[model samples]
Target: MNWIHSSKRFFNNFQREILAFIHRKNLGKLSPLYDDSKWEPGHWYAEHYQRHFAPLRLKKLKILEIGVGGYDDPKAGGRSLRMWKKYFRNSLIYGIDLVKKKALEENRIKIFQGSQTDESFLRDVLAETGGLDIIIEDGSSSNEAHIKTFKTLFPALNEGGIYAAENIHHSYWPSLSGERWSSLAKGSIFLENWIGCGGSLDLNDPKTLMNMYKRLVDGLNYQDFLRPGYSPSYFDKHIVSIHFYPNLVILYKGNNDKPSNFIENNALRPFVLEKLGVESLEELGLEFSLDNSTPECTHLELSKR
Candidate 1:
């Protein structure tokens, strides 16, 4: 048994070296590198990744990818880690899985065994990595896990870092995604039966990772929200951009403090009314009272008429 394990280890290392040699000259696109490492195919995710990753290819980075490829079998995964290491030549690639994969670790590549939803374990990993420049959540394919892991890890990511959620299409699959659709009208047979028939693609499902990310989009414009005393959530203040792809969602983190031209201190500025050729708030169809001391419309009250 010991000899068998040794043979497997020897063959795996040998195969890695051979593949490395074969693809040593071709380092143009990440898709080819994925193929070289026998990870997910190029057609699946290469284009989107290339668009985002190509710019950071040369920078030294710390990247963490949730859900290393193999299941239960400690020796079966790490394909994508190798691919990432090759693509980001100056990066430290870290992967986490439910099963221990210590055998897969190599220079510039580290593996941790833990559940994605375990906050403590994630924090420990973050401490070891110091901080993350990029995080790719490809674990479990469960929307619940995706959302949980994201909320826990995204805040730990460095400013201007990239956070990506893969397999988000699973949000539509009731069985695999663990997202529950709201119950339809019990009184209406047609509406109740039609709900979740083929699979729920409910954009309103707040539980799904997709909708959660979609909601974060509004955060990018937190400066423009007209609500009084509205405090931007951590996500709103830090999430600078959100990009949605087929089964992927990528978030860019940065300061989101850009003020809206029309608003000041959360109130609509008086100049906006002048630009609209309105002498008063009434002329603009906004039933709002101008502060007796200031020209700015501090309180808005819509006319019933």
Candidate 2:
């Protein structure tokens, strides 16, 4: 029976390698391969990932995905890791999970066991990987975990790399809060009451992962912010673009040094009025009663200087 199972596994792996080679040769759709796997259906993520990943299919890359599937079962997961392996022929695939999935280790694939929010664990993983070309946050699916893991691992992502968060709809679920729930008998409440209390669904909540990423959108235009002695956050200086999809967000990492057309050194240039086809606010049918005491007016006056 062991021999039979080994033969079957070998045959499956060989078949997949052949299919993957043909798929790469023909520029085939990834949806079929995703649908064939236990990771997820093609409709959920394959197309969106294809749009972003297809270009890099031939590149030798190191990719990390958080949360190997099958939960606490050590030997039962690695479906998505296998999918990624087939998809990126030239790439090495790595997965992190709380469970030790040493059984899933294969050629060009590795697994690490640790909390996603642990910087030390992640740093050690990076030591082995050198640096990551892509990172997919599919762990735990809690708001706090998303934010913390991103903060920990994003800095290690290579320049021009891609960082993606998956299952972000969990950010809106009341059940999965910033931390995992112990049980309803302890401190957790009923779903109805949780919703009634605004729960994690509140868009204004800073603790939610979606809101955290939304804040990064402003960082994309950090140069346009008008303030004295303004300093750009690390994200503001590095996050070049962010794309939102259903249950997913992809952030492109690179130099975000594009200066604002109308501003330089955090001061509005006088030529901005000319660019707007107006010499002054009055010409543009706009009026402001400047009050020197107000910070708004002070910035305005400073811009004029």
* Residue 271 of model 1, lDDT score: 93
Instruction: State in Å the error of residue 113, model 1.
Output: 0.9
Q: Which candidate has the top score in TM-score? A: 2
In Å, residue 270's CA in model 1 sits off its true spot by 3.2
What digit string (tens of lDDT, one per residue) describes model 1 on residues 28-121?
Answer: 4433534432224422565677778778987899999987765657797787788888778898999998879999999999999898888777
lDDT string for model 2 (174-242, tens) is: 653442333432432233223322227576776777888888898788787654346667787888999
Candidate 1 displacement at residue 48 in angstroms: 1.1
Quick one: best lDDT, which candidate?
2
TM-score, candidate 1, is 0.74
TM-score for each model:
0.74, 0.76
Off by over 4 Å in 1: 1-43, 176-201, 273-305
